[model samples]
Target: MRKALTLIGTGLAAALALTACGGSDSTPSADATLDPANPTTITVGATPVPQGRILEFVDENLAKDAGIDLDIKEFTDYQTPNIALSDGSLDANYFQHLAFFDQQVADKGYDFEHGEGIHIEPYAGFSSKHQSVDDIPEGATVAVTNDPGNQPRALKMLEAEGLLAGIEDDSAALTLTDEQNPKGLKFEENQPEILVQLIDDPKVDLAIINGNFILDAGLNTDDAVIVESAENNPYANFLAWKAGDDNPAIAKLEELLHSPDVKKFIEETWPNGDVFPAF
Candidate 1:
C-alpha cells in the first residue's frame, strides 16, 4: 500500500506539471504573430514639393506590390524631418542631398546615413522683372544664397554663365572670390528661400534659386531665365536612415526607386526637365 501511494503521488505531480505547461502554452505571447520580415506599415518623412509627391506615388505603387502600407509625413522645414527620423517617429526621409546629409550628421552628431541616389533637381537663376539673361544691366544687384552649401552652388551658377571666372573647375571649396564679373555686377547674399521675395523688389535684378525653393515658391522651371544642366551634377537627392538599419525594407525601397517605372514617371511628370532621375 505504501508503494502504491507513492506511485499515485508521482502520477498526480506529472499530471499537474502537464496542466501547467498546457496553460503556459495556451496563453499567447506578444510576439507570437509578429514577423519582422513582413512589416505592415512604413512611415517616411518628406517635404511637400516633388519629393513628397514622388514618395506618395512610390508608396501607392510599391507598397501595394510589397503588401505593405506606406505613410508619408510632410514637413516644411529642413530640420524636422531628420529629427523625426532619429526619434523613430519616421522610418526614413527622402528630401536631402548627400552633402546636406553629411553636414547634418556632422553638425548635430546624429547617427544617420544616406542610401541610394534618388533624383536631381537643378538649381537655376530666375528673374521676374528681366525677361532674358542678357537683359540685366551693369551694376545690377544679383541675389544669391547665404547658406554655406547653397552659397557655393549659387556662385557656381554665376560662374557657369561666364559672369564669374576665378574659381577652379573642380574646386568644391570655391567662394565668392571666384566672381570675376566684367560688368561690375553687385551681389546680395540672403537665404535662398527668401530670395524669391526679393523678386518684388526693383533693386534685386535676378536671384539664383534652388530647385526645391523654386518649386515651393510656385514658380515654373521653364520660366527661369537660366537653368542648370542635368547631365552631371553630383548633388542628387537620396534616402536617409539610421546608421545601422541594414534592413531588407531599405534594400527593397532602393530597388524600387532605381527601377524603370520611377524613371519613366519622373520623365513624364517633369517634362520641362526641372527634375531628372539619378538612376
Candidate 2:
C-alpha cells in the first residue's frame, strides 16, 4: 500500500508538472514568511477546484478569528506552486500529495515541508456507457493517467477489481494483455488533466480520473463506476511550505485548515465523497 501510494503521488506530480518540468526552468522566488500574530495576509498557492474553495472558506469564515488575513493565489497547474513556494512568492501551497512533495523536493532540491494531510482526492474510474465494473465488456479501451503518482492508483484499483495482476514496476511501462487482463481490456494513457476531457469520447471505455478533476468538472463521485478505496489511501493532498521556515501565519492557516469549520464544510459540500478529509 505504501509503495502504491508513493507511486501515485509521484505520478500525479509529474502529470501536474507536464507542461514544464519541475526543479528549474521557472523563475526564482524570494523566501516567503508570515507574521503569526499580525497576519495581515498570508499568500498561498493552490489548484482552483477544492483547494481554492476550501481556502476561500477559511479566509471568509475562519481566518479572522485567529487574526489571520488570508490571501489565496490560484495556480492552474502543479508546476507553478512549487516554483512560487520555493522562491518565496507563496507562503505555502496545498495542491500536492506527500509522494509528489517528496519526489519534487528531492529532484528539484527544494526545501519544503507539509502540514498534516488536509484531504484525499480519491483516484477513480468513470464510464458514461458502462453502468458498473462487471458490465464492462471485452476489448474495452480504458484510459489511465500517464504519470507515475496517479498511474499506480489506477492500476491498483484495477488490480483490486480483479482486472489485472500486481505491478512490480512503478512507471508508465504498463501494458494490458490477456495474461494479466483476462477481459482483453485495451489501455490508453494520457496526462491526468487531459483524461477528464476524454471522458465523453466514444473511443474511451473508462477514464481513470482524479477526484479533484471530477469535482472541478462539476461531476459527482456518485456517478463514478469505480473509486479507489479510501482506507489507507496515500493520495491525500496537504498544505506545504518551505522547510525550516516556521512562519506563524502559515502555521495558523494550517491549524485552521484542519479545524472543525473546514471539516464541516468539506463534509457538507462533498457529500458524494469526491474530497475526503484526511485530517
Candidate 3:
C-alpha cells in the first residue's frame, strides 16, 4: 500500500508519445522566463534517504551560487512523487530509476524529460534467518517488491543465486515460473517500503530490497547475502521534470548533481558500496 505523504521543508502538493501531445490540466506548465537578477526556486520531490540528502547538499553548497533555490519535498512512497510532478505539486522529481520511469511513462502517459544518471543503488537480498544464500532451504518464503519495474530485478537476483531460473531480466511482466523453481522457493510480493519489515518477519526467509529502502531502514549492505553488481547497471536514478520544461535552474541543478563534489559526497557517505556515483 502507498503511504500517505507529507512534504519535507515545504507544503506538499503523463505518459506515452501521443499522450505527451494530449496535455492534461494536471501537467506542469513549462517554466516561464526568469529574470537574470533574481534567484529561482525549483520545487523537486524525492525519496528521504540519498535523494533528499543529496539535494540538501546541493541546496546548501551549490544552489545559491548557481542562482537557484531548491525546495525539496521528500516522499516515502514511489508512486506519489511522480503523481505530484504530474499534478503540478512539484516542479521535478529525483526518486525513480530509468526502468521505473519508463514504466510510469508508458503506463500513465507522463510527458516528462529526465537528466543523465546521477547515482546507482545496488539491489540486494537479505536474510535474517539464514547466514548465506546456500543456507536457504526448499519452500522458503522470499519477499520481493511488488512494483512492476523492480520485481524482475529481484527475480533476476534470485536466479543468480541459483534459487530460481528461466527469468528474463528485462521483462517488466516477469513472474516466477513454477517449473523453474529449482529450490521450490515460495515468493511473496510487497511494496518496496514494506520489504524491509518483511526482512524481520519470521515467515519470510529472504527479503530482496531496494538499496534506498535498505538505507532508510538502517540496514547494512555488508549483511546482504547477495547484492547486485553495479557494473554497467542501468538503474541509476536521475532528475526528471515535465517535458518541454526549459528551466535554466533545473539544468544547473542537474549539472551540480553530476559534479565532482557530489561524487565525493556519495562516495564518502556510502563508502560501503551501497550507493555508487553513476557519472
Candidate that scores best on lDDT: 3
Worst 10 contiguous positions by lDDT, candidate 1: 19-28
The residue pairs in collision within model 1 are none
Higher-ranked by lDDT: 1 or 3: 3
Residue-wise lDDT of candidate 2 within 72-184, one digit each (tens)? 78765566678777767778888988667766665666767777788988888888789899988988889987766557678878888887775543634256445667777
**Using Cα atoms with residue i matched to residue i, what is each candidate's TM-score against the true structure?**
0.78, 0.81, 0.87
lDDT of 2 at 256: 85
Q: Arrange candidates, best lDDT first.
A: 3, 2, 1
Q: Which RMSD values do the candidates have, in order?
A: 18.7, 7.8, 5.5
Provide the overall lDDT of each model, using Cα atoms, as 2-decimal numbers: 0.67, 0.74, 0.79
| Candidate 2, number of clashes | 8
Candidate 2 clashing pairs, residues 3+ apart or interchain: 7-149, 8-149, 10-149, 11-148, 11-149, 29-87, 30-87, 30-88
lDDT of 1 by residue, 3-34 (tens): 10000122232232111100000111122232
Model 3, span 1-279: residue lDDT tens: 112246432223123122453222122222434443577888988898888889988888877777778888878888878777877788888988877888777776778888888999999989889999879999999888878878887787777778777788564322445766777787888878889988879999989999899899888889898898887788999999888776778877788899999999999999988899999
Which portions of model 1 show Cα errors greater than 4 Å?
A: 1-39, 168-175, 178-184
Better of 2 and 3 by lDDT: 3
Write the number of the candidate with greater lDDT, choosing between 1 and 2: 2
With candidate 2 superimposed using the best TM-score fit, by how many Å does residue 84's alpha carbon deviate from the native? Answer: 1.9
Best by TM-score: 3
TM-score rank, highest first?
3, 2, 1
